[model samples]
Target: MLQKFGFTQYESQVYEAIFAQDQPLDATSIVNYSNVPKAKIYEVLNRLIDKGTVLTTMHGKKKLYMAVDLQSIILKIRADFEKDIEELKTYKIKRTFTDEHIWTLKDASSIASNIEQLIEEADSSILFLAWNEQMDKYRELLEQKEAEGVHVEVLAVGGLQSSLTHKYSLIPMIEDSKLEPSQLIIVDYAYLLFAGIEHDSWKAIKTTSKPIVKALTDYFYHDVALTQITKKYGDQLLQDEEIARLLARLIY
Candidate 1:
């Protein structure tokens, strides 16, 4: 585990042994205390000295080594690892997709984290179809996007008899749904993420495909418009059931 910080086993043992003492030790003392091979002691010590983990001085004809401050080693190792990661990230960064492409996120266990990323990526608009369970799972991210000035509209479905709050305009569209408890997210009119938590795993398909996006957007708009019509005409339906049935049959 410590090897990633650039310490070999023998080198780590020698370096740690020196740290365990208040006084500096010669190589012979480090070898005995750390149980490292006596032959490998000076070689490991030299490497540690080069890494600034160990400091060397002369005591008459013999050499003594001391461990550097623990805090200094920690800071140096962290900076070195961060620099390495930045360098590695620069090689062949792939960040584009075709308009016809689709991507899938298949991890059900971390599905909330994936949704959080989608919410963060949204710039101007967000449309979501959420169930009560999904609202609980992703409440903070939804709130965050609302604060960021994205125009958020949601169609809330089953498991809750009422809305989570009235702060966001929501339409209760729960007669029946294939996407019940499944989440449909459209971000910035550019990307779509539809994810469902299944019995065995989470299955999701994300896309930038124009045809698919357009089709889903149309469906979303139709339902939203129908919800408005229902609210406006509900009281008028009390006078006659025939007209109500006809509108239901036509819209549904």
Candidate 2:
């Protein structure tokens, strides 16, 4: 485990051995307990001390070494990692050119993270369509954006019980959906992310392409409109044979 944090093998062994001891140990004692080569024991101890993972004390003419407190070391590591992340963020370049390429994203976690990022970056509005679970996952974020004056709208697969002004409709138009479960999101009229299960795996495509974004935006608008219309005239539409046939042909 210490090696994962960049500890050398001998340094890790020495530290563990010292930590396991009740008191500080001399180099010979550490080598005996850690089973590290006697020739390399002092070298490893010095490196560990330099790294602040080990401390030294002078007892008479003898130098003794002890492992630093585990919690202190862990906290230091975490602080360093966070500092690096903040510094890395400052290096991000603002793009001057329009990137119209569609990029594929795989797995549920990846898709969710990307969507959350897009939502967080929205300066104007967020238009989303997804299942109830997704709506639940992002409802707080959407509400936050709404509070910040971003026009937030959601079309949930289940119910429209949220603070955002939106619509909801069940997939009754298709009797049996052979299509995979999917989600749609448009952010600031610029970013578009469309995701669905494909071959039993989560797959998504994201893009900033103007044409594609406009096309999907229209699709989302029509979907919301249809859902609103269905909520009002659903029974009547289902009652008509011709309308029912056309509705049955409509699939995601």
Candidate 3:
């Protein structure tokens, strides 16, 4: 554990030997307790001092070394880790194009975890289309993202009540329509995730491909438009012969 933070074996031994004592120890005593070679003890002490893991002081004419407190070292390590993480968050790689790979996630657990991560990564907007059960699975995550100022819009099937801005799917009104419920989500226009239940198991695929993302985003937008149009002109649109014919040609 001590070596994990860049401590050499000799330095770690010397520090532990000194830390086990109630007071600081001189070079000779440190070498005796740590089993470090006499020739290497001073070098180890100097390195530990440079790392701020050990301190030095004079007791009369003899210099003594002491290990820093364990809690202090832990706090310093935590601070360094946090600083690195913050710096990493600001870094952006310059890439001319996105990778064209679509990753498949098998099983319900994998899909659920991936969707949760995508929702958490969303910084701007989340466009969702899903049935009640699928919507319920991620409803809290979507709500939390919305509270963090991410725009969440949903096109929901069945009667799933949520605080998000959503439109009801017309498939539910078809009465005779037999459509299996599925989930589609686009996050920040960068990620697309689609999943459905098959044979009582979940199958999902995710991608950052530009064409796929744009196609699905357009699909969600068109669905939203259709829902609004149907709500506004339900009877009138059905009465129009041409519109009725077009509606009949649509796949339920």
Candidate 4:
């Protein structure tokens, strides 16, 4: 849907008609074929043309409109979106971690897949601090890692009862906890993953270095102050507190 991209109803309809037709039509023809009002057809066509969804050419004294190739337009839209996202991510990295190189991921599936890959690559242990939401979604991945003999330590807003048939440990809720702001996963003392979701999509930033990972691991292990705060007021926090906490623990 182009709703999230800020397309209006008429604009979407015009664009869809053009995309479906795959051929250029004059404004009169568009009005007749699409059943849109004659008065509005020209406006729609001009708007679509401006947006690169339609192409116009002069045929005699009249202008003929043609649909831009749908595939090419879609690819261009996606490419532009990705480029903009990368620029935003670069700015965020510059402000947040000035010395670290950053990479951006654009989709939820990629975030899940990357988390799985990081877990699999762990040679020693996997340390995770997740909010309730992320734990619910990524529980299976953690279980799989545990099955592969990876030591898994998880701290979450709530407590887990049954320890699965794997090398997994869970810390129960602490009283008066202060929830963190993102999801975090550290792998084998070598890599870290920070992830978040917004508008039904997810993004992740990852880093790998033995020293950096080791320092993070130790910091997480010994940061009893943070641990205590998270334990106490974990539930009564932000809307995406769980996911944010998890990401923060892993990346920050």
Task: Report the number of the highest-TM-score candidate.
Answer: 2
- lDDT of each residue in 56-147, candidate 1, tens digit only: 99999999988999899999999988998987644442347666878887887556666666777677888877666676566666666777
The parts of candidate 1 lying over 4 Å away from their true place are: 4-14, 17-22, 26-65, 68-94, 105-107, 158-179, 197-202, 237-252
Show where candidate 3 strays beyond 4 Å.
Answer: 4-8, 35-56, 68-96, 133-150, 166-179, 229-252
| CA lDDT of each prediction against the hidden true structure | 0.72, 0.83, 0.82, 0.65
For candidate 2, lDDT tens digit of each residue in 1-252? 799998988888899999999999998899899999998987888899888899999999999988899999999889988999988744544457899899999889999999988888788999998877676798888888888899988887755567775546555455334534678999989999999888888899999999999999998888787777777888999899988777654425
What's each prediction's TM-score? 0.60, 0.66, 0.66, 0.41
Clash totals, every prediction: 0, 0, 0, 23
State which candidate, 2 or 3, has the greater TM-score.
2
**Where does candidate 3 have its weakest 10-residue lDDT segment?**
167-176
**Candidate 2 to native Cα RMSD, angstroms:** 5.4
Worst 10 residues of 2 by lDDT: 171-180
Off by over 4 Å in 2: 1-71, 79-94, 170-179, 249-251
Q: What ranking of all candidate models by TM-score puts the best one first?
A: 2, 3, 1, 4
Worst 10 residues of 4 by lDDT: 90-99
Per residue, candidate 3 scores C-alpha lDDT tens digits across 1-252 of: 688887778888998999999988999999899999999998889988887889999989999888999998889888988999988765655446887899987788888777877787788999988877777888888888898899888887665677776536554555534566678889999889999867877888899999999998998888778767876886799898888767643323
